[model samples]
Target: MKLQDQPPLHLTYGLSIHPDETWPELWASIQEKALAVRARVAPGKAFGLGLRLRDAVSREMAEGGNLRRFRQFLDENGLYIFTLNGFPYGRFHGGRVKEQVYAPDWRTEARLDYTRRLADLLAVLLPDGVAGSISTVPGSFKPWIHGASDVERITDQLARAVAHLAGLKEKTGREIHLGLEPEPGCLFETPDELIRFMQEWMWPRGRVRVARELGCSLAAAEQKVRLHLGVCLDTCHVAVCFEDPEEALRQYQAAGLRISKIQLSAALEADAVGRAALARFIEPVYLHQVVADLGGGRLRSWLDLPEALAALGSLPEARAVRVHFHIPLHFEGGGGLRSTTFALRPSFFRALQNGATEHLEIETYSFDALPGGASRDVVESVAGEYRWVLQRLVRAN
Candidate 1:
């Protein structure tokens, strides 16, 4: 038998590690942090950046002179932004974010307007012939959707955004897309749930609105919506929900859904014996949704680690629990703690090697929430993760 060659990998590696809350501060952080990572990780090369623009900073970046100024900075530094973390619309750090992160969800005009601005900004930033993607919230927070009106509102809003994106592509001659990211407790926690929402509500409702708005046939509108909007598959989120990344990828592929990007990250996991170590991760800054498998396909969840800990005595003991803590790719926990990196099987990497998705990001956004992360040099830590992923890609080839 003869060996077949692997297809060429058109992959880009990055870290969505920006944590600043203001424009000047963010610019300084990018100039310092992004450049330091580049110098250490891909010296003298085009380093791909996963830009995190807060709502205020997004406005600032769009204002006069700043956009061009930032583009000049990118040119000088040999850094390129290939993706934006659109999930955070405001105040990402230095305050308690919690579930408020999912506010102004897909049901509102605010979410649609903000997403449209990002699409406009990304279309300008993307290099010629390079497609762009923005990962956003998965509809609304699970607890907030009270009835059919909310679902209908979100469906119509997203369809409007999809229509706007199609118009942007036609006007700019660039393809900038939106990827709804699913979290453990969000409206669409699992790939199965997300696809169900898409087929049942989004596709059926979106096609009509999109077709009417674009003055096109229903079939063309569905195709356009699918092309411009898709899944931003976050490995950590899916793993924390007790789902395998490869299996989720297979599900997405089977459903005729597009994977706009893949956030390469790992979640923390521990069995009954290692449960004590999870206490160190409880913090005030962000919500860390926890999911536990109680055997026999029975699963339970809590909004945060503390709630899970508080209810542990009353509920049946779980076989294992996974935390939505974005652990560094290179870190396998000691002291009875482990990461869900094991869930990233060989098939996932093989799919990447075959261009399953064009965008790959090292999204350790919560490194600061990890134990001793504040004292660690984030740029150096991210650079190590960049090496970890690059080496894996090399070995996979």
Candidate 2:
């Protein structure tokens, strides 16, 4: 599928390497791992690389050179710079890597300073033509979504950040696109709220807000500031809100806002008594099916999983069949069989064949937040899972 009016073939899928793996040794290991991954994909299907930054400042300091090297790594490895992670913000100095807001006063001067600094760093490392995703900026949290900041202050914060980003664009001569992700707990939670913010306040050319009313469109009220913001589709975040994945895609697509990124991850499906009961547990409400091509040599052969397994035959071209998978780890403990884990369903595999989505990014970064000791193993597990899916895709197509 084409996005940003770009060619469809520019589509690709990338892996987000955890921030913990940013060090030299781990970074090298990740390169080796990713190399193995690249060797498996078809010749012309473009792919990319995603770098997750834990603490922007710390990464700038400790891994600055490493960062540069990583960019070179991307080139050497045939991967494009996909995303620069900005989440669980805070320090990663020692044990207990904390997630804190450096800007406790998001409405005041602190937030601007932080934003400027971050924009500055990102501009340097991420030049222009780079697409970025911003999640849970300090003021974006809980009560904030419920009428949190006064109009003047929120507007100011947004202005400064936007200005800084714009300034970076001029300096770099690159059209860096920012996807203002509407997360579940942030101030700009829903698509409606975010879209309204963009249309009303931010992008109106000249708009300035003096009063922040519950439903007042910022642009209608102000003439000094205009927002140039767009949307970032985090499937898991949307899924948790019980929104239909396909419907969400269509809505945003209709809105004319960029689909910054389509985060591919499984949503949890519940173990229930029936279909209705089970429906409540689907995190994304719906998930994309994994499509692959088996050795049968064809352009692309589409087939459902169980049926394909049963009707094994040779093909004229090498193509892939898609399969659906759900996310959010599910486990059970009872009946004298206490255990914790996830379940893979074949039907989930059947669903992906419905769309023409070209680019997809594997976003299983939540594993980074797992209990302390499990980081490495968890990352490896995710890698293995992706490889398994890729193998199946290869076989089916």
Candidate 3:
């Protein structure tokens, strides 16, 4: 069978690796990194980019003539955008992004506005007859929500966002879905948490609210909610949470939740004996949430690598520690650290075989933070990641 005859999947590398907050800087990064990577990896094929736009850049691009120029640039470069990384609303690098990454969570109008803008931008940028996806933060950081009222507010905000997406679809005829990404230490971190949020809060109340807003029946409204709101399965995050990707994908499918995009990435895994070696990853720029799988199906979680290291004495003995570090997808074993790359293959293959998701984005956003990553050629590393993932997908088919 020919490669094109196999399952159709859109493969791209997330542009979040480039920390360009403005349009000029962003375009430069794309020219320097994205184009270079595409040239080396994809060559003649029309490459897709998982664009990551900050709030400022989004606004600027939305201005008169800017987005058009960008589209022209993509056309000239043989590049197209099918997915966006809207998870971070602001600065993601060169500073302490830690927990502040989830600042304007789904509970606020700001989050809604930002996402709506993204949808609008995507509607224009998305190629004709191609669907687009925007991956966002999962509600809020778990620690920030005080009680049921906070959760209620989040659901209300999400309902509004869904209504906005429905309107976008009505206006542009482009079906862009919001993928609520579940990360470690976030509100809906675990698979169970995500499932519960959709079933309990989103479905029960969201359906009615959406029904009222869209002037549709409850069943139709529920369908809209399901179509608009879905999961962005980040392999690094899921692996860090000790989730068996196959089982998690099955659970999402069984629950009727769409996997909008699968972020092809890897997490750092270290056994108890190799725990000391993980200290190198305890940086201050990003929050490296760690989960240690304790016996009897219990897991001990920490907010960051430091907290995990500090509580090492108090926590019970664990099998392995999965750190929420976006390592290079191409390289698996190095520096006494093993990658969760192994988990990605089975999950990715199964998802593709089962028609789970069409968008597959290589999202190694922490390239700057990785060891030796600073000195390495960013284009080469990203291109290598694209090559690695594409090879796997081809082999799987």
User: lDDT per prediction?
Assistant: 0.84, 0.43, 0.86
lDDT of 1 by residue, 53-171 (tens): 87788899999999898888887877677688889888877889999999779988888889999888888887776778999999989999998888888889989999999999999
In model 2, which runs have C-alpha deviations exceeding 4 angstroms? 1-29, 39-47, 56-70, 91-139, 144-148, 204-228, 271-359, 368-397
Q: Pick the candidate with the highest lDDT.
A: 3
Better of 1 and 2 by lDDT: 1
- Steric overlap count per candidate: 0, 51, 0
For 242-295, candidate 2 gives per-residue lDDT tens digits of: 445556666766766655555555443222112123222222211222223444
**Total backbone clashes of model 3?**
0
| Tens-place lDDT digits, model 3, residues 1-397 | 0113245567888888997877888998889888788789877878888889989889999998999999999988888888999999999878999999998988898888999899999999988777889999999999999999988999988888889889889998999999999998899987899999999999989988888888999999999999999999888898999897778888898999989998878999987767888887777798999999887898999989998988875664787888999999887675557989888664467566556787888888889898778999888888788778767766775
User: What are the clashing pairs of model 1?
Assistant: none
> By the TM-score metric, which is better: model 1 or model 2?
1
Task: Quote each prediction's TM-score.
Answer: 0.95, 0.58, 0.96
> Where does candidate 1 stray beyond 4 Å?
1-16
